[model samples]
Target: MSADLLLSKLEGVRRTGPGRWVARCSAHPDKNPSLNVREVEDGRVLVKCFAECDVESILSAVGLGWDAIMPPRAIDHHVKRERRPFNAHDVLVALETELTIASLAMLDIGKGKMPSDAERERLLLASRRIRSAIELAVDND
Candidate 1:
């Protein structure tokens, strides 16, 4: 609920500060403005009676309910989540290791001989790791 709507229902409302005001307590008879009303940055209305009146009682008197002034259930404003599971340093280290393996295999092939069975397995693992790193880097962005 907006502060203006709440203030309209109140009597003898006077500005106390930015986004804040004082009004006569609707729950009880008041000769002075004892009720405090405020609108916070998150768009929630706040009400308090200095005569020690409960919030529920003050809201009830003004035809307002708990639901009208409740805070938002979920606020996603400026929330930054961890988009990548692995940090850049870790990913770089992994890619470097895979590159070393691939380089060794390439060197063997450049020597006019194919990599042995075990070297072939290592090359396959390196290929898979490089492909996986590429996917993670692209998808997270």
Candidate 2:
């Protein structure tokens, strides 16, 4: 299917840059153009709704099925699929929890109270997790 068909169904559609567009998502009551649409060289179209509406719902709202966006074709076995196992948001959330544990343990020590064996182990775990997160960020950066 043509991307023009999808854009025709969208309200407030406008070009952003080459092969990119912004439009109002019909799946939700969008006050602005919260939907992003991009056409790649492979003729595959990508659609994203910033309002967190699932792609399926957005497509359905426009009376388009998956075939409109993703035309079925032969799969390329040689292409490598990218995987981001740890996103920044999840990594930061984990780091925050670990830091909170260490902070509370430090406060206990400041009050002249010794942390138990479990607390010490948890502190060690926090340090390890922090180190791991740093490595992940650095390598990706």
Candidate 2's C-alpha lDDT? 0.86
What's each prediction's TM-score? 0.50, 0.51
User: Tens-digit lDDT track for model 1 on 37-110?
Assistant: 99887778888888899989888898977666664441333354446466989888988898998888888799
Candidate 2 lDDT, 1-141, residue by residue in tens? 447888989999999999899999989999899999999877778899998999999989989987887656514323434445668788889989999999999999999999999999999999998998888767655
TM-score for candidate 2, please give it.
0.51
Best by TM-score: 2
